[model samples]
Target: MTMTFIIVYVVIALILVGLVNLFMSKRKRKMKTQRTEQTLSENDTSHQSYQSKFNIRDTDETSEANDANAISEENGKLNISNNSDETEALTSDQNAVTQHEESHTQEEEINEKLKQKHSAFMFGKGTSQGKVLIAMIFGMFIAILNQTLLNVALPKINTDFNISANTGQWLMTGFMLVNGILIPISAFLFNKYSYRKLFLVAMTLFTLGSLVCGISGSFTIMMVGRVLQAIGAGILMPLGTNVFMTIFPPEKRGAAMGTLGIAMILAPAIGPTLSGYIVENYHWNIMFYGMFIIGLISLAIAYIWFRVYQVTTNPKADIPGIIFSTIGFGSLLYGFSEAGNNSWTAPSVVITLLLGVVFIVAFVIRELTMRVPMLNLEVLKYSGFTLTTIINMIVTMSLFGGMILLPLYLQNLRGFTPLQSGLLLLPGALIMGFMGPIAGRLLDTIGIKPLALIGTGIMTYATWELTKLNMNTTYSHLMVIYIIRSFGMSFIMMPIMTAGMNSLPQRLISHGNALSNTLRQLAGSIGTALLVTVMSTQTTQYVSTYSQDLDKTNPFIKDRLQEMAQAMGGEQMATQKILEFVQKLASINGVNSAFLVATALSALAFILSLFLRGKEHYISKE
Candidate 1:
């Protein structure tokens, strides 16, 4: 059909535009690098530049006696007694210049020492933040990987458990439900306990969960394991972020978040591919076994590394806030997760969704009225946090849309093996891992607006290209587009999130992190439901149109039927084949439609990102 050609033309149209946008992003990074060099050069030539980075104040009492010669030169040119001491004055000026250079060198040395001392790795080489960050990244990577690894193994799990798809899905839904409940509660936990204690609890729970899942024989037992994993994982992510915010200065947080983003990007990227291999060859339970062992290692490292950087305050527990948060977020996420399998209008779906909204409203009111809120609703008052949150939610939905659709297109319609399908995403994932830290540094140097703008711009163009998917679309084409999409995403998620956190005062970072993660979690589920709904809705229309054309009245159908009939040996076989082809085409059309919706969302995110204030908007760190 002529519709198949639409995909080709769309790809062609987008390639040049995508290239142009990517080139502009590259140019911006270069420009930012050059500015950094120029600033360094200026700092070397002038003492005034030291005021900002090194805090060189003019207060005489605070001045270093070792550097007094440099200051004396500036105090009316050393007050030389006419021509009698002209030679002496010249010598004094030379001495003053040397002292200035030495003072600058000393400042640089102190900065370098601080940088090394705070580094994130430890073989006894770094301090609390760096060691803890490394351990958290390791633990978080495995936790995220465990989720994706389970996705690839779910079908196998269903067969083994002799359960229906709906029953099997409980494994994932349960994990998410626990995560949602725990995430909001994390802010309260952070307020009440030291991070060292939280890290121990989180890692212990996760490692234990992995062991339970690996060894459990019954479905009920496995569900228990999943809940444990969720409890551990839910706390780990937000707690890791909160610790980073506490330990690192505001100016450096972009890079720190970016460093954390490496695990975030790589785990999901590598998981499916790795899981596909393991699932294809080995028993499914082996994954949990591996996760269990790795979890123990992570647990041990995190325990040794995480430190209590600050004392915890005991905020009075908001028991009512706790109930509302759990009920509201849990019900809402559950409803969204179910909507794709059972239509949105299903009675159960509608009831839960309505309940979720009502409870969420009640929860918000309770938080607002409370003296010390459980989740800190007041963080939304900052315009920067609010704007980025909306944009983050939108982009997250679009991201989940792409992530879901591409694999379905690859393995279902295209009939690629799971390994092949996952490997296609690996390149993009690896690239994103590489770019994560770079994007963060750029965010620090150039700010969030540029990174967000360029990221969303590329995402918009790339997703727009995916809307052209058809039965005839090539595997390579899908992979290329997906890679471009991943590249754009690396620049967006962590940087935008860090920008939102930076908007809040120091005390509220944990709450902001909690809210951001919780909503994004909700957004991911809602996006999955909505995009899948769009696909199925479009599939129905296309199927109807296609079914109508399958009648003998259509000449194109006549020719196709005749060709298939001669090749396959019977009219019945030919008709059946055509019907199969029609269904496949209709499904492919649905995927394209989903991507189109994603493209529009990306465009809207780009527009909203344009309004996100840069690093200049950040509250100064305490």
Candidate 2:
């Protein structure tokens, strides 16, 4: 039934495209004919005027020659007419015609300018570039949203599948690992294939993945679906970004990318909140089913809307590069991911991390030497792209890594409902969504440094505020800070990314996009791991310290315990309650410690912002 529906949908889509294309062709032909006729009429008038002037001159010369011939015949004397005035008039006529043509050309140039302005006003109406982005953003939105949605649904999924926490986490970890692996490969895919084919293939995989997940009865099948979704999503983002860079010029790129940033930030921000509501009321599969339906819609829109921006070309594959990238990024991401659950120093984590570093080094060396690299390292030679990429990684870590801390504090420590926890983030997400375009405009006007500094400053302040969170911290307080933080974020991400990408030459855009994404992915994973490690390690220390400090023999603790025991059923129950309280205190302390680290990261980004500028001009690509 699904296959049949898809086939029918495609048939309908093709018919619709045929009609639209027909209309577009007719409109274009009519416009072309009008321009041609107008040009011909102008040319004919100019030609006739020139011909008439020459004819007048010729007639005078002819009459004069006839008279001269008669004189010569009658008296054997020769005569000639100078006719300088006629010659001057003919020269003047030629100048007038040239000026008329120049003026007409100017008018046409002005008309073209007007058309461009009108197109800009319409936000790329009657343009395939706009339609492509519009369609792709939907897929990007759902794919990124899928990343966070499962975070909220994991508890329910765990119960349904009868899995352990570590086991359930693989659903998230596996998705990240797969996504990280595919991102590097996507740049190669982009260079070798047209945008249309890649978009259709990516959306198909994503939509199919959603279907698999929606119907999965076990964890193994669910993992398969998640991996499929990851592969599709991983390609969609960099591809969309590269297409944007290809179509929009530098001046317009900031605003255009900023527009895309809405989907980039908003989708993940609202995912958990939306997922929370669904998980609270519906079955876990509903989330996947919802994705499946939306994915189909997005796929259809993409099919109808996308244009072929780049034609397929053969690029020599680097097998060594591929192997190194897969092992390096995959192992590194897995290491960071597991570092959160297991300690950083665990044998497996240590081994994988070391292996990742070694392979990544080899990969970099391979790319640097290769004539046709799998992932180009030449983009890094531009100081502007290099700097922005570093700052981007830092900002991503501080921004996304810090995001997880709130949910942990709200839901686990404070016992807030998942919906309530998600709602806490809703206001912030909405703020970023609203401000993305505004910041884009700001980026174009004020420049990259100003926005970067201002954003970092606000983010630093907001993250500093999070360190003050405690058992009694008000929910409103958290929401307010997150909103402010979101505002700061709106200015930081897109502008910085655009500046970096814009710094690269046209040929290197794909490489720059891929490398930037690869690093950002690593940073997010590492940041999350680092922050979680700090929390876990600190919590354990705090628990031990609290236990040691609250000695049973101490008069102070003894008095408190007696009063609690007298009020409660027994001393043992009071002791248990005290232990639980101590554990909560330790956990909050650990959370605060994590926030402090995040604050420092944000501050470091702020300091780095001082050095940030707009895209640098390329001396040469080689």
Candidate 3:
């Protein structure tokens, strides 16, 4: 149904545009014919005047021999009159030609404006590259809105479903899974379609998904809606990065992308807080509905300000590449999803992990051998690009890993509500949002490598600090650490993207962008899953070990257990209290360990950045 809808709309749009072109062409031909007739009339008048002057000169020769001096003066006066008439006619012809030329020039300028307007949909429109910057800003805002809008609604969803923290996180995990699976596919689709049409389609789908989510009565239905929205996000997220690079000349890509980074970092960070406020004051459904409205507005802009009817050469789909990507990514995420519920030793978890590994291996082999590949593996031949991509992956892993772990820690262990947990992220998000653009402007003057190194170093240090948090840590302390950590990310994110893209050839920007976005998605998936799985495993182990020491015979243990029971006051409540305490304490310890691992990941990113060679700015077009 979606495919058919897209095709029909594109055809109708093109037909209308074809008619407009036809009208303009016919008008130009008519004007050209009229100008030709006027030029012919001017030539005939000039020829007649030349013949009269010759006739008068021959007659004067005969008359001057007969009448002498008196007739000579009369002949001179007649010659002056003829010359004056010829000069007046010549001036009149010149004026007519000049007026015709001016009209033609005006028409050509009008045609150029029409051409620019037509190109705006597919390639975007502007004289000074300002439109490229504007499109990027819009893309950035949309990306941020997609994720952040869900934050406030997560708690309401959890409470309504009566689910565990792990189960409730599916709101986020489901979106990630769908988005992760489709990123490569988006790359293929983007190349095969017009940018304006694709963007509008994405926005429309997103809006429809939001409406579906708002009306859903069941968890399954809501998840289905989320899946729909994820498809749009999957495409747009990558599109935003690549489109800017394609629209702008190489020299300004960093500055442009840097401006985009503000929205990128700001969205996820702010999503939770805004979601919290909306859900708390109103209802969860309202949040989704609001997103729907925003999507519609974007769609309207696309229709009015852009043209989406350009044709494309449909490349053969890479079947092997698609299979490998789907299976590899699908199985990997499945393993993580299962780990949230099932033990690592469980048959289901084991099988999923094994399949994921096998598919990933197959994907690598297929990409290496294909002639016209979906993912161009040849770019990896450049050492700087390869290392930079790896670093990007590592950085995203740690960033997303913490995004998952931190919220869970606050809600499950510290007994904070969803609103409070989201609030906790606000300060960090605010700091990073403001800093992103500043970093971009700085990169324009200073080198990308230095800025990237400095940012990663701070991120590494921040990760180490996060590893030190425990159950008893104060909110104020966590807030300070999060702020510092976010500030560091603001520096690293834009510079790396700008530098790597700048290094690529102009023709390779699209492919390079596709690869970069794909890697970031992979990193987020791997990082989130690893963090969750490790926390779950370690928490269960800690609970079991501690249970052995909490026997009734141990005096200190007995006293502590009795005190907890008395604080609850009822037998049923006492048992529940003990279990909750055990779970909460275990989680705190597990999260600290995860943060330590994140620290290690950030360090690896730092090492990879060192291999990124010298800074490469986008090459300017002549």
Candidate 4:
């Protein structure tokens, strides 16, 4: 037992060490990527600035060319260069020059107007690529930390609350359900409020929620706190992506958004192990307490470094649109969240699902018809954007959906501690964490398709390996599987983001990004719900089948039962103990089979990834 404990400790430590290394490496990579992107943006700016001054010269050139053309038309009769001001201004002479120059000057003026509009849209006075990247990356960390920290703390919450296995899921499920509803509303808020203000508000809500959750005396209070965190998290998720597009140049947005994938992997990697330590040695509330402090620090940093005074605003609060988006997304997620606990055939489940569908459909019709739409549907006209968004949803479902199963299987079935289970996730989490940014950087050089293929291929293998896990599987075997899956996730995530953003106009970047992030969150929620439902249903079947051989009439079983009862203090107590033990054993096996179901979902994700198109690295046409 000591040896096993030591091994577990070592595994946990290694995973943390690996994650720290990966984090450090990504920071370094980010700096390097930032420098390169900055240099390119600077060069573009310099070229555009130079071209602006150069245009003054062109206006004069056009005037001179028109004068020459007039002179030729008159057989050198105009001689405007030598003429007196009064002579040159004569009606007959001026009219001749005006006739030749009229259409040409009008064309030049139109061209200049178009150029100014393009410049205003792409490089607004206050917006800078560097500033946007910084803000978005920070948002990424906040969003990720919010979700991942809770994952580690859930088990301790279950023990403390004395909740059922299914009830325990609400801690996670509720967060996602609330978060999903918040995402669509967030897009409108981003337009309505300053990004800096919205971000600070969200962080504040999250911090406050953490405090509430940490100090709560009852499950009800804890649930409310979780809801607070969800609200903040929902806003930040899409906002993070929006910031990237708004701030970064069209060409460099891929590398900027890639940082988010790194955050996604890193948050989960650190959250579980760190929270595990907190729960084991201290109180489970320590997770939220820690989150509160982190949130405060992030909030301060964001406010100080990222200014709100300069935030662009042309917001008209679309009350109708906001209502539709919230109700639509909220109902849909609620249905998924409730599905794991309630009978699928129950009226509540059916009614909630139907309501979800109705709201979503209404949201679509309303957004399309609105004169000033909150979500610009025009961006979806791009095939690359549409396809990548689908890919994002599928991958998110696979990754987040499968994540719900593995930890549960390790802890409930294999009897591993939270720390040990989290340690197991570390390898994959770290690898994938690094994979996303690296793939993002690679998007700078090669292309997205090959990287995506590589990612999907690894995921396929990892999913296949997952299908093979059983009750007696060793730690080493699981580690290998996680590593492959993490690497695949890293490869696939960035490419999908880059591909989608690459196809959009700079002005629509924020709206497009918001859509992508929203889908990713929805995918996670749906995936988690789907997997939980599968596991619960499948486990019931497995338990019934496994219990079949314990017939009461068998002579050997009957003799063994009598002997067991004799060994115990009394027959009555012995029978009770035997039944409890049997139920526990069945529960463990049931969880193991649930993981097998998760493996199948991942396999499905791999198949979907195959259909997605490759990288769309930006090359300026002009």
TM-score of each: 0.79, 0.80, 0.73, 0.75
CA lDDT, every prediction?
0.80, 0.80, 0.70, 0.68
What lDDT tens digits, residue by residue, belong to model 1 across residues 320-390?
Answer: 77778777887788889879777999877887788789989999998888877888887888888889899
> Can you tell me which runs of candidate 3 are displaced by over 4 Å?
1-128, 151-155, 158-174, 219-224, 306-312, 548-583, 617-622
Q: Model 4 over residues 1-622: C-alpha lDDT tens digits?
A: 2223223322432343234335434444554466457656766775676566557656765776687667666755765354564465475456756754764576567567645443332433464556545665665675677677766667678888887656667667667666665566555566545566667777777789889998998787887788778777877777777766555565565677677777766886777777788877998887788778878877766766665332244456565665666656766666666675566776666776787788778888988998877888887888777876786787777777677778877887778988898888887877877667667777766766677667777786777677666667899888888887888878777777777777777656667777777777767767777777777776677657756877768898778778888898677776677666666566655555655655565566566656655444333222
Q: List candidate 4 segments past 4 Å from native.
A: 1-136, 152-174, 212-227, 307-313, 552-604, 608-610, 614-622
Estimate the lDDT of model 1: 0.80
Candidate 3 per-residue lDDT over residues 1-622, each given as its tens digit: 2223223322432342244235434544564466457645654664456446545754664464455446446867777456765576568557656755665576567556654443343443432345545654565476557776765576678787677666666667667666666676665666566566567666766788888988988777786688678777777787787777666556566677777887788777777777777777887888788788877777766566544333333456676677677666766666665665556677766876787789878987887887766777666755556666788889988998898888888887788877788788888888887887788777766767778788999999998999877778899998899999998998888777777776776445567777787777767767877777788777888888767655767898667767877887865686677777777777777888888889999998888767656544333231
Clashing pairs in 1: 120-130
Work out how many backbone clashes candidate 3 has. 4
> How well does candidate 1 match the true structure in TM-score terms?
0.79
Cα lDDT, model 2, residue 136: 72
Error of 1 at 263 (Å): 0.9
